[model samples]
Target chain A: MQKNIAQGNLIPFVSVQQMVALIDSLGVEAFMTELAGYIEEDFKQWSLFDKSPRFASHSEVGVIELMPTSNGKAFSFKYVNGHPGNTRHGLQTVTAFGVLADVDTGYPVLLSEMTLLTALRTAATSALMAKYLAPEGADTMAMIGNGSQSEFQALAFKAMLGIRSLRLYDIEPAASRKLQRNLQDRGFDIVVCDSAQAAVEGARIITTCTADKRNATILTEQMVGSGVYINAIGGDCPGKTELDPLLLHRARVFVEYEPQTRIEGEIQQLAADFPVTEMWRVISGQADGRRAQDELLVFDGVGFAVEDFSALRYVYEKLSDNQGYDKLDMIADPDDPRDLFGMYLRLAPSRKGEAA
Target chain B: MQKNIAQGNLIPFVSVQQMVALIDSLGVEAFMTELAGYIEEDFKQWSLFDKSPRFASHSEVGVIELMPTSNGKAFSFKYVNGHPGNTRHGLQTVTAFGVLADVDTGYPVLLSEMTLLTALRTAATSALMAKYLAPEGADTMAMIGNGSQSEFQALAFKAMLGIRSLRLYDIEPAASRKLQRNLQDRGFDIVVCDSAQAAVEGARIITTCTADKRNATILTEQMVGSGVYINAIGGDCPGKTELDPLLLHRARVFVEYEPQTRIEGEIQQLAADFPVTEMWRVISGQADGRRAQDELLVFDGVGFAVEDFSALRYVYEKLSDNQGYDKLDMIADPDDPRDLFGMYLRLAPSRKGEAA
Candidate 1:
């Protein structure tokens, strides 16, 4: 699906299949390191982005969201959904796509499938959070959700934090086996644990990426050790939280965006006055990240638009080498500012012939 | 092209080409009538929507906006841009596209080009406003901007309001001539006037649908009479207004959403405390629209997301037989929730061979 139909214009799209291929080709470890770099670059000059809370529609069955962001030059938006019961019908619980457009022209430069990219970015964000929030010299992580995003999370920790070992646990044994098997040829060692307790027994960093979409305590207050960073990814919507309120009180919580976190992140379980820090401040060296080892920390990871912008940019850069057409004629070209009628003149005979 | 490859799924996107075809197929008059009906139905049940002011990013060249709305079940968002200078580069000055998605599943149900739809909906909105603002038996309209959208506006007035006569004016004679050419077969009594004053001479309804993204006063206080129903569609973004401040003071200004219109509509030039009524209130029969034949009324329409929702619904019904697809495998579907690794095995081997 690559075309170089136009000389100066190339609208490269990363489809779900292409994204999967990109991730599988590079392996998850390399993808995370590169993605984290992109995120870090954007976060350093974070104020330049026109950031707004995602517009969401919540129905009883699931939730749909639109997250958009712009840095004076380009605009990007992601369309995503979270339906927990989708797997029963052979559909993934969450699926997504996004668009990146030129701010000057408002023309979409890229349209990408973000389903796989979402997993990559989430893992990358977790690794970035661990760089600051996790205990010094953290080498191993307990992965609570050994499902769709488990592999990416495992490799991110391995590449970024030198986490040579992964203790994986899922509600279903097959999930743990699948994750353990995927890492068979990969460099990292994987341990299939029977329970959450077994997974976290000796792990320095605990990453809870479960998919229940409900308020469930995957990690109890006692199971958490001193200085461990918790990357809570699943409990992102209202009424969906992974940590016990007590655990949040003990840990210094960090969020992607505060307003969204208040409603969608694990912080939703806590009160309005719950103290939290934005991740960008820590990355930019403006705020205190970790005071001392053994201080509990939490990256209440509710995905943000900035992460999507980073992913769109990464995919656009990658696809440029392969080349794809601006095959999608997404806009009308009015030759004269006031003359839309002129556009129709050329369409007449040619279109009728094509239609026949 | 309308795709019907699949039996049940309809994929009749209003692509730039299809939009041009849509106009050419039914002519602009019929398009506007149906568009007005769509706008009216959504406005009638205004309480069902979760409405917010459009999210916008203004760069030096133009402004890009995302307008999102939902009615608990389905959510829709339109990505539109108003780059007034884009036409010089063989692109539309105002181009757009939007999507309708299931709120629960987050799957996009429709992705349609809105460049032509924007023209349709804007005209429909004006016609809808005329329904409430115009005095009974009003039949003549003065179309001030004879540009891209001028035909749609002209046709909407003719179809929706029984407006059979038009006094047309534009700085460029060619634009006015073009409008007359496309509209000749529709049988409206059209008079191409030399000036804006000449255009408004005896018309009962005055429409200013200009294209300039500046504060150009296309309509002044001296031109408009007491009883004229004014459709102010051009003055949408900040610094882009068509009506003079004096004319706004004299007229019973009506708006789609007062808070939004105050910032983006003709009312932007008026005082903060200026008296105005939301057109929805009038549609809901809660407010008095026209006090007498001599009372002035202005419908300030800056496009809304609900209208896009209505358009999506209308297009779905119109092209229920069309079908097309790109089977995006973005989400990981594991037979068992925990067996996500199996998907990697299934996808990777096949993909790598293809990559090689």
Candidate 2:
């Protein structure tokens, strides 16, 4: 049982752009479809995982969190940060990286730039919920927040659910214009809306992805009609939320990991005993999904580690054939482990300079 | 305020041997003295820190963890792994790395290889504790667990406290021999003992750093004298402990952080209401250190994130003036801030296929 990272070997390190290209080459639709399958499968055997709520460190400016999860065979962890006011400083709201390792050996097999992968997985998770919760052939989606993550969600829906028409709205109209322009030749019909109300007017799915870190009610209970799937993406921290309490109460709420969702999801505003279904149950066929055509279902997305684990797995496979990764010498190897001092002297210059 | 990490455009990674060289260049004694002062300063404003117990992913072979801490001015984190069984695999039992960043900008100012730094920091912490807990003229110490970290613990005590004699013991005789051989010319009088009893005989301080992830009775209550200071290092993680519960009951235990120690330190064996003082309290003069010369003081060392934070800060200052570091485009810098997709086109072409 003496497992190891192996001698004279390197772990796969994928850059953000390399991963974006890898995922793009994999195709957003195919990736989303495959990613959903991995999430669905992991969720089915959920009892095998050792789970814990994310460990978060918050400051006045932003938050940095570490989310770790392990299935019996492998372990994964993501180091992520969210800074809502960051864009004002000319930085992205989120920046991240992660490592996946062998459960037995404790050697990182995949060290990846997860900034872009996070966007892919978040969108993938949303589309995954739509696959199980949306009505048959649901095509039109009203995207309320059109920022950096907007195009990702748009493309995921377009590729996975065959979403054809997108009615987009944002606090800044330029964001909507950018989303529309990016998908111009991609064959999806797009419409720019004046407000959130106009965006959700006749859409089958309404996605509220605003980046406000406050208790702002972007979607009222009345605004969210029946038979609509709402992907609430931006309200991920405490004191930050999107859906009105009434809307949360009315919708058939589904969550990735309940204890985490209770603290960081839209349900953070609600009572602890607030009834909600774990998404895995629905995907595993053990629980009902979209009970009625007019049932308003809320997929409260604070984002989860399992999705990132799947994303890491997805990109690891893609980097196998690509020629663009840097091999980092992260771990040390010695002929004799007990002679670390000797190893150090041989590897680095002597502690004493000159001929001493 | 939006803080950006893009302007400097340097990755600045430090390898283990490089960090050792950096510390050596700065003078080990001077570095240790400065680090101790920094640790003391941070401890004075301890309430401002957001601290938590490390998140560990454990398996039969080894354990990997993420230890994160943040003050208002800065954020720091360490990625470390321990596998006592790794000796057979030709790797050190503990391997680690970490990053220190500005709180406002969220940019990593230093990403260091802490495999050796961890050992350095741990020894520095112990030496700092010895300054407060050990009597004014402490001379000899029993160095239990003669592994990779032993020589470091030995040297730090020699450099910082002017300890003149040493006694070493390990389960593996060869390890003890290696430690003895390495420190032969290092100023301290080294003695290799056959048994733990032989090592602790007539010693002023007892340092138990055995690496078994079990409740091993490395030092029993009978083995410890009333006035002897105990530097308990290797007992970390939930079921892993070095001392017996009886020892904790008698010793005036000083922990790094109470919440974290309650889970991973010798205090884990105590009741939930167990009274233990944070080491920072003693450092800040808020709590008494060594009430009586005969009082037993235990530095229940699981290693704190804040110590790593201080260590990273010290090394960052040491290396900031140096010229050897690789600059990585780990962060996304979109010109429009709205068009992250546009940055890839501007990224550097493959340094590959270039005449290296």
Candidate 3:
């Protein structure tokens, strides 16, 4: 349903159905590549952003967070929840939505369901970082924990870096089969492995994205070979770490935002004073990324808000050509801002018999 | 404009149009009075809540904030912006919307436009405080700053306190005239005064709700009488206050939450060690509200998140009988949860030609 444009209260909203349509219409591969470009561009200009760590409300089972950031011209925030047990009840472990607003007027311009968009952006960001930090001429990736995000990661790497090979592993074998089936005709040389070690064999890049809330060692130091790039994504909050501490000790770490990664990333397992480089510096040619040929590197990603800001910005731009969005009468634009009460009073007679 | 409910992905949304209709259908006075009951009840059980100071991002002309709270059962947050310059552009000075989610599942149950609801709840909270702190038989209220929130405050005081007389004043005479026109035939003896002092001449309760973003003293120490309840509503954020420092020093201050009020309320002008009482204690009969008939009292309302939570709760309950809402297809409720990618892939065929 659409609201009157003249009212100037309409906010364009992209729903899950519309998001899926948007992704399919653009095609997953092309969309991820374009999203990666936007992510890289935002990273290059990261100094212009007003960045802050996400504000989280932790519960016994999970957490819900508000991640907000802006670049003076536009403001965006993502409302996301992480409930690892949600998948057990036939729900996604992570579900999200975001809003993009005009910073000048403090008014929201776009609201979009970010569950699918988050998955796309997460993979796009990982690949964008890999483009700079990954091993030279890397053509194969080992995806450990083949859950909901596995397919997107596989496709993003393929689209962005021409990586046409995937070795998949999951604690639950059914999850591995699901990932394999989803990527069947997507032009990838796929292999289903029995263990994380087996998945990492003959692969130059290892991506770990488990859903466990505890500090579990999905990848040990011995399993991670040198000259490889590790995309550690699962250990996002405190008490959640995917890679062993010894592995991080031997690797040169890169992070999206240092302050947040120290608390919410795999680096949380290390000392507070542990060294890490911000990826924006490398992207902007302000710092060196990879020094040695066989030096191990880790991208400790906790999903920063700027990436979501870029994703929302991309969706807002796409609205001009996309029909998969609806207008929401979200803001109250009264004829006279002070006569807000009168707006209701005048509508009282017409709506008198409508209330049940 | 409602979506199919059987999908289990629908989130009920009440827009500004629907919210106005809902308030008018419920009858404004009755709605405000009932909302006050909810606010009082929530205050009585305040210890059961998880409260936090609002996280605000301030800009040159405005501030955007996310206020979140939970009761271990239901979680809610409000996305609101305060831009004093917005009125010049024909927009609301303060605009808002909120979401209510299940604590266990972390799924949003309802999303509603909160510009009108905020006006209603703020007035309800003020009136609730006045009911506890005002002198006995206080019928006349001097409403200084007759803006968007002024009429609601007047109506709420009339409904809750049986105050049948109102003396209104504003810097802009047109705003006072608008308020007077809106409140005519509402069973009140309305008097539009020329200045703030003339408005508060014989009133026992003085409400100052101006929208200036600076520390402008709307009420001076000399203008206030010895025994009067001050409803200070406008000076919420830092560098923005409506009352003179001497006035706060003379009045016994009461706050919704002490820590938050110390930074955002008029009390921000005073020393950090200044004593203030939380209103819940008075509502719970744990502390005295108004000490003496001749003693001054101030309800420094910064507008906490719990009131928004209560307002959202009220709207959620009313959704059962109200059709003035739409279902938002927000959550991506995949059947297997892990097959989120497959769900989108299947829709690809149907959305073949939709991409431009």
Candidate 4:
């Protein structure tokens, strides 16, 4: 039987292929740059957002979390999972999808694959923080882990902060080689270092993103120089950290949301009352970013819902022309709202046969 | 450019059309009867599931909520919204979609439209409760507020408890007429009544399901008779209720989840320490369902996540043959888990041109 669904029932869905095609039309660097602009705009209006820590379900091997946020007019949420052991089974360590809905009508307007969007938004957030905290004219970065996020980090910095020199290190040499090969033609001076210390020798910005589900000090106190910016992104869950406790004492930490960062970011190793600055305050000019050239600034990044919200909003705005999305009939709409049963009756096989 | 995504990246999606087709093939009454079986199976093992109050974001006009539950091996969450004023705009007051994921790998395996599924599950849950609490050989039911859920409730009772007669009433007369017309060919002896009091006369079961976002009582203490089962399903949010305080005190209440029911169910009108039995205990025989023929039993159901979990599990199991689903490329997968950038680079327009 043929059925015609109402327009309100169709949700715009962006699949992985459509996401790739959209990014291809707009170069990756430009997309991140544009996405960063959206993040910045939302951060400027930070106080308007309703923020809460993600609801996470932990298992023996992994975690599934729902991060939700809204700004009175619109609501957005991301469903994400992190499983460090998934790579052994040929699966991504992180996978995500998100939805943007109108708060007034309580209807979802857009749905998109957020695995790639998460990577892009994470990198954009890192670069946005570095824009305020990094030293003057810093052009070199030390990437301590070369995994799924390494190339995005490099390109975002290049697009936002003009960082063109890189030093990379990973536990697996193949990972670093993979990163080099991916960025070979992206216009950068690259060096593959054997150790984290060697990677940070002359760089003014150091980014640590490792994939172990344990506490590992990839950067020690002595390895971090004065006046350098530290972007820590991989220590996102409890008991999963990447910085030395001593290093946190030396740096002035800034976080996306303090309540969440205290439990999931690098600062999870520190005391509950450890003082930190919220990045929104910095972006809104309520707090200082870098006080002195010799001062250390650490952006304790654990990823936040607002960043995903910004990414979802960006994709939703870009979907106006309907070029990068498919219409998904995901809602049940009857001619009369109270007649859902009548609608179903019309679709019944016996009813269809009778109508024929 | 053509890219081959791994099997793990594709999630099986059941759209509204597919859901209708699946129900048509199975027949609605049989479908709900089988779904009630699944709900019973899960309720029997209720202690093993992770239960949490739904996360709600309330606005002036509506509310959006996320209800999540898991049983160690699998996880499920439903995104639903409620807007009482949506009908005036030709929209459903309730719309939902859900996800089922494998906890072992933290990957979603199934996504389905849950608007229709929610109606079916709610009806199944009510009828499942009636199987234990309704007076013996109860064949007649009084259905108050014949909205989207009225026909489903009638059919589920017919399928599960052999209730062949229904007395329906609604403030909007058109709603009752619509429900009667929908179930006219389904072998039900239905009477569309003008008043709730008149509808409950001579009925052994009374079901109250209205769509007002207020504390208005649809059933009074004097109207309800002893030895009857009361299924309260629509008083499902804070500050919204359907039963009078006197009526709640007169009935022995059973709830899906006590902590949640105290906040969102008909019992929300009573004191915080009001006594209630959990339905799982009743189903497992830990608590008595109906002690005497004259004892009043009320199933104060403010739909729980476990019921939705059961529905998601049911659909996931039915998708094995892939007849009622579409493959959605919603995850980003790289040949090497760490080489997501390489995967994106291959999809670059310049790279596609070069390959050509």
Candidate 5:
């Protein structure tokens, strides 16, 4: 049955089960570490990429966005939705899927469930940015809002930045416990804090990933100490923001894409002209990262298309030797390109027994 | 093995083979006729839909676009690519796939190969518009550029408007012969014309569905008679257009979406302020279609997201009783919505034997 599908029509599709199996095979931390490297490589040559602000369709409940980018060689886009109320109905607050296509032919080569991949890439990007912007010798991270992404963030930081200690806090203690339980045997010294204020006690790095659609300051001005690197992940849409504006004023903000970050990042609260460095420039050594030891730094990550592109590209390259992909008959490939109608006719029940 | 997968994780994926099978089972003309009804229903309630111009990424050779729209309940988007030069390499000039998601949950419910679906919907849309725009008792269609979409247009017009006579012409004589051969036994009088002039000689409806990426004058101003309804389908991207500008000036132009058609349709040659009636308005009876017998009508179809939405919705509804769809594990659904990490950990080799 599979042999009947032409080569051009078959796209490698990685399902959620396959993604889990693949991640388990490689180990989540190692997968993210490699994914981070792909991201860094792309960021180094970011000038070659075609970057556009994500196209978002907003509704009363949520927003669905399509983030597309290309580096002339490959094109990738992620279909993601953010509905904060989804968790209440036993659904994920955010779920995603993406496609990687060949730029030469505009043919999709891979389709993968990005719900898992998005978490991995977001964490990878946070850690990759921390490598440049975090205070030197940072060994502890204060993770606010320990939800689905907490363990991934913790592991990514551990893998990329050698952070062994974590202070976790969430509005619901069960969420923090869930994070702590998930990371318990993962070789980390964990502390479950009662409040956001208590979570940041001695940690040099602070990661806020609260999922609220409105502007609620997860970290205020007084909570953020000097020289502490803040990775703000959840304030990712128009009305959603995490850091206090004053905190943004005190910190040197870095973002994946300026135009997108201006609208979707924590810096959305700030002015249009508020100074922010594009992370690609810093990764490429064209700009500064951490200017001073006591300089407050914020990696305002709303998630960019390039990071997803990198993740998809990483998976596509790995699938050559990986066991977690299925060939999907997605593209229509008629023997005669102009004879699609003839191809349709040949698929009829009467014509099915005849040779092509 | 299928029982192990969660229900929320599975999306109904209609592949090319599946689409072909579904179309064949229903019969292409019947399927398109039903699809045309869906298109008309949506067009009637056009104000309820969220319409945005397609997000396109252009390469040197072609363009890849994402067309997204919603009607408050269901959201749909089509990922389509147009590479005119692809046929030279034995690939379709256009290939597409689309997804239909629930607006309330922001979870995808259907993923379908839209190369076949797109052809169907484009033809359906053309025919639907002609039902309103075409002259009374119009039976014959002069199909210039008899490529992949020619037979579809012919059958759709036949299914919807009783158009049984097709006058076909292509730059390549082989393409015209291929079209004629396919539709020969399908109960149509098909004329394989040598030139564009000969094709449109006496027909009341002139359909141009070429695959060039440039502004080609497939139909000159003098060739289009005063009483003809022109269905122009080829000029769908920036710098790609069909029909002479003077002919557009002479005709009362109707478009799928005015904003898109201004940039991509034959009207791209005209000023941005050039008058064109929105097809939805005509469908909804807010505007007149054919005011007089001799007044020229042009359905400047650049294709819109709503039409794809209608097609996807039609398929999704039909799949309830249809046999040609596979349950694909495309979305990640953890037992606990906030325990995605735990889900990943549980998938490990050590935890394989453990029961949930």
Candidate 6:
């Protein structure tokens, strides 16, 4: 009876506004730090997850995708869209929302806006991977294509790895300026660089997050230095990548899920049989992470469903103390499950009164 | 500018309470009739749509599924779960929600509670198939399962095909009693029968919607009469079917989508190479329906995503006059397409004030 009462017809929904409030209340740096913990834990148990490459419906302009993964007890999926042309229309290039459901009863428990959460989780995953793949004592990061994701990446590194310096660069000068302005009071010593080459100079961690859909060389082989880690996030989806094929050939590559990364990540540029280590294997201690401090590690990140599942589980866990969500009457709950028709008929009179 | 304004970050959500209100305002019979028309229209243009077998995540207890389909202009996916044991926990055996998005933009235009809509669409689909496959002047339906979907099926037949009598039977007699009580004033002459054999004694349309996760014979070879349209609904997943294989062998089987029906519909009990007509071809006048007056016709209904798309599109159209929906701030919309961090920072202060 208690389970039934708790599992009422309502689902808890956290909107974009609530997501911003949650981050603001927790403070951005602290929130990213806590988020990295969840991502790290899920990565440690990565073998337990049911993973799949996202299902995508594509058009000339962009794609709408559903990324679903489950850890036996809980299932989560993110509905996300990406339109490079959307920027011209005053919209974010990407927007998303996600759901967490109970695997036991196959009922949804939480639904939340994931655009902001994605930024947070992507940053967290980047930093969590850096903790394993980046060279020891690497504090300065070169963030190329300083667009929407630049500040989160900056803050996540600062919180998770004590990265005290950020050198940012964007093709458009205005984007780098905006990144600097946003991270002004966030306690990072930020440097606005003239080009991607200038941004990577003297930095051990180089993050390339350009949003172009073309196969451009954001980071050529000559630009990547020995012992430096390359966090490649923009080369997601086929026909889009950041690092040069030569850089991938020279560096020891790591990935989220090899089967998916082969198709969507920067590794898409590599041969079908190209060798890559699954990051989960490293996190689970089933495989070695960095063979040497100067091994030239490449984390070809395209993002994965398990990270979203971890984020949703974290939000579901945190909702108990946060009142930033609203209850939605999303499920039809009749007193007798067999009498769904009777329930509708019973509500007819009341609806008529309201209409009148 | 108008396009940008119209494509705002808000998604319209029709909740369960609003769904019932919308149905009540329209009258259930009238609503089902209108819904059938939309389904028929979509089926006519079925060749223009992208179709795939639904993606399902299975568990010991039940399954959660994502059904996605798209036309060149619009896309839709339904998140649904089916748990036969849920009734014991006071939950509907099935609950669903769906999203419709612009194929050009990948942004969700509408989010609707699909539990009620699913029932409506499923019933409408059954009647729509019957219109093409049922024998002429068939006015009696033997509804073998009298649970959640029975009344909608009964009423759909009444409104669409002028079915004036219903021969109802269920393993649990109380379910049949509830169905009879609900249809008391719906202008149908209903008879409660003791067995599946007794129920189809004098009916032209026999619908079996029993919900069990195993192979069970709700209809045997001798029970199915000549010239009856069998709407099989319950055998919607792997290893779950209702009718005897002999009936399928003798009947001219019709299906929504051949690939999906082969795995989830009653056809799963038949041979992998069993012949089945695609229903859309018949609706479009490309195939024959009811080949002979005495020929057995089986419309193996496992449900498909296009029906949900049609239902969501219909609901999106009807929402213009109905104020029964809530606007969800489900998408992250930042002023500068590349300035997601700046947008969160801008909202940070307002959220802080609300939290305080």
Candidate 4 stretches with Cα past 4 Å from truth are: A1-6, A353-356, B1-6, B353-356
Which has the better lDDT: candidate 1, or candidate 6? Answer: 6
Interface RMSD of each: 3.9, 4.0, 3.3, 1.9, 1.7, 2.7
- The list of candidate 3 runs beyond 4 A from truth reads A1-7, A349-356, B1-7, B349-356
lDDT of 6 by residue, A1-356 (tens): 01222256788899998888888888888888888888889888887788877898988888889999988788899999988887676666788999999888888888999999999999999999998898999899999998888889999999888899999989999988888888877788999999899999999999999978789999889887799999999888888998899999998899999888888888887799989999989888888888898789999998999999989888777775337788888888888888888778766655344321
Off by over 4 Å in 1: A1-11, A85-91, A135-137, A245-252, A269-275, A287-296, A321-326, A348-356, B1-14, B135-139, B284-295, B323-345, B349-356
Backbone atom clashes (below 3 Å) for every candidate: 6, 3, 0, 0, 0, 1
Q: Locate the minimum summed-lDDT window of 10 residues in model 3 chain B.
A: B1-10
Q: For model 1, what is the error of residue A141's alpha carbon versus the real structure, in angstroms, after optimal superposition?
A: 2.2
Query: What are the root-mean-square deviations of the candidates from the true structure over C-alphas?
Result: 4.1, 4.3, 3.6, 3.6, 3.4, 2.8
The C-alpha lDDT values of all candidates are 0.78, 0.77, 0.86, 0.89, 0.88, 0.87
Best by lDDT: 4
Which regions of candidate 5 fall more than 4 Å away from where they truly are? A1-6, A354-356, B1-6, B354-356
Give every collision pair in model 4: none
lDDT of 5 by residue, A220-334 (tens): 8998788899999988877889889999998889998999889888888888999999999999999999988899999999888999999999988777533568988899888
Tens-place lDDT per residue, model 4, A154-263, is 99999999999999999999999989988888899999999998999999999999987789999999888898999999898889999999999999999999998998
Tell how far residue A121 is off in model 5, in angstroms: 0.7
Number of the predicted model whose DockQ against the real structure is largest: 4
| Second chain TM-score for model 5 | 0.95
lDDT of 5 at A345: 75
User: Please, what are the lDDT tens digits per residue for candidate 3 over residues B1-356?
Assistant: 12122225778899888888788778888888999988898899999898977877778888888899987777899999988788788877778999988777677778999999999999999999999999989999999999889889988999989889999989999999888888877898999999999999999999999878789999999999887999999888888899999999998999999999988899999999888999999999999999888989999999999999999888777665337788898888777777778778765666455431
Q: For all the predictions, what are the DockQ values?
A: 0.45, 0.36, 0.53, 0.67, 0.66, 0.62
True contacts kept of each: 0.65, 0.32, 0.65, 0.81, 0.75, 0.78
Worst 10 residues of 2 chain A by lDDT: A1-10
Report the poorest 10 consecutive residues by lDDT, candidate 6 chain B.
B1-10
